[model samples]
Target: MGESSWAIDLEKQITTAEVDEEEIKRWVIDLEKNMEEEEMKTSRSIFKVPTQTTLLHKNAYEPNIVSFGPYHYGKSHLQLMETHKKKAVDYFLKNYGKPLNNYVKALEEVDQELRDSYENLDDEWKHREKFLKLMMFDGCFMLKILYEYKETLAKPGSENHDHFNFDPQLCLYIRRDMLMIENQLPLLGLVTLAAVQTGKSTVLFVLSFCYFLKLESNSKNSPYSNYINSTVFAEHTGVLNLPILIMDEITEISFLNLMAFERKAKGMGSAVSSFLAFMGSLINSEEDARFLRSKGIIQSTLGNDKAIVDCIKLLGKDMYFNPHSEMCLTQYRLNQYYLNSIKSWNKRLRDWSSNFMQTYVKNPWTLISLMVAGFVLSLTVTQTYYSIHKPK
Candidate 1:
């Protein structure tokens, strides 16, 4: 009886070992499948702020007035915009003559691709149905804003037609909120929805968006307005050259988010990074801010040159920039420009000239003495010349 019991126990041990091996094999296969799926979705664009960057200025990455994407969708502070978003969506669909279901279906098609663009999405938001609804609302809200801005620009008095057109300051905040890194919907999503509504080419729609950015950056009376308007409307075939480096609370947030996106997307040589680097190089001091103001490069409503300088300096802190990127090249060019500036000259002749002016030309008493000495010397020279050659 004891021998029979030992054999049964030995057989049970072997069976358990075989079952463990089978479970291990199943786990490996599942892991490989998950990895393959991740690889297929690796081309992400939008991202959560890295902890390192967020620690520098958390508020800059957050939307103050409105939230567009799922990242900030459920915040208590941002919930007020939900009604506004619904109204905008309704307005957009009504104008486009499409039912809300049509837009919902359109977004559903690209739901997975849209999900892939954002990182660290919550488990609740990971549901396909919930994410699709988010894309429809947020995407349409953005398109509505852009479409309204375009209409307002094309027809000066058309802003009154929009229900959400508030005070200028509120509008300014909304504009700034839209550009916040975390507050963005995918450009492809916006373009796709716009195409569904307007039947306009993507290129033209993007250009119109660029035009809105330009107009937002510049004041109505800005001297550069004409040039910017012409460049955007002219026969240019490249990306629009929007001036995004202005030193202000809004622009600083906008650029920081854009720079963050460029960094995450591995677009190290992008125009956004280059512009930021260029602006950072140009704004190291109050004098630098003043110089940019004189050149019409800084169009900030924020008061005081020091404020602009400080804002720019703050924006550059904790930023990740590649040394060999286009932004670095822009920094190199700026350094070269500074080295060639007249203020940077320190040659012997320049030193002597500066010293001479400071000592003999700057003080009233020394200037008067120099003038007297010059007159006396001129008289002496005239007298000596007359004595030598006067009646010869």
Candidate 2:
């Protein structure tokens, strides 16, 4: 009877072990599948902004008036530009001086390359014909917009503005939308179209857009170094620099997209994040933004200084500061300089002088009174000294 009881317990333990082994196998299979999917997705460059980021500023990452890629292709609000896209196709064909089929063929050749550019392209765009159409239209429209932008830059106030029938405000919205991360069309598609159009290399055409945005590699020197002038940093003795930032309506969108790309793209450097974080440190309030604006360090086309402050704060939020980055190390150095300055007598004198001027000198009359009073005190001191030493 004891042997039979022991045999039953051993059978139960064997059954439990088999069940656990099966469960472990299932978990391993699921993890492998998930990892495979993630690995596939990771190769794409363009991506939807993370939900947490969009929740912070939904409009910053979304297209408003025009849709470019598959992400925002069919939104109702952006549908108004569909007709303009057709117009853009017409203009692009004419400007290319080629048959429509030539450009279409060019795009068809790179269809797979374009599809691979997007991380989460929808099934609706899976059909080769549909996807090719999207690439052609969006690419042509983007090319048209960029050409018009170049023309506008070359001839700033010439009444000849061809915006594919979009009014000025809508055109501005298109520009802003183009800077969004998810609203990006593949560069390969654009380059193909441009090459087909110009019958030449795409370098010059691509450089036009780069030049428009002034996208340049950052220097190792201080970002605040004012190559043009150091007048803004005149008050400071040791550090002779001030940041030169140009803030416009699209500045926020440009910065947010660039930072998002940096965050998403593996091996991509964090220059944008670093610069924005540094700016965020400098701009704690509207007053700081306004002071920079007044000193010409910040040139804002936005409505107010507060908008600039809010935008910088928004960009700088949720950023990871890489301690080894140039900007981060520079910030550390600046902080140390500030701390040392606080301990120095020269800084204290400057601070006192600034406080006295702000507190006591309300106007020219107050300054004049202080100067006269100082003169009187000096005269009395002189007289007292002479009186104390008379003929002795």
The top-ranked prediction according to lDDT is: 2
C-alpha lDDT of residue 14 in model 2: 87
For model 1, the superposed segments whose C-alpha errors exceed 4 Å read: 1-31, 34-41, 199-245, 268-275, 330-392
Q: lDDT tens string, model 1, 1-392?
A: 36698898999898886557888999999999999767744667677888888888878788888888788888888787788878878887777797777777778787777877777778998788887878877777776676677678788976565778578787788887877667777777886777778766354444544543443444444443242232231112322233433455566766677777776765334555544555666578989888777767667778999888777777678455568655565456545555655464567678899999999988989999999999999999999999999894
How many residue-pair clashes does candidate 2 contain? 0
Which pairs clash in model 2? none
In the range 31-57, model 2's lDDT, one tens digit per residue, is: 999997777666678988999998977
The whole-model lDDT of each prediction reads 0.70, 0.76
The whole-model C-alpha lDDT of candidate 2 against the native structure comes to 0.76
Q: In model 1, state the lDDT of residue 384.
A: 98
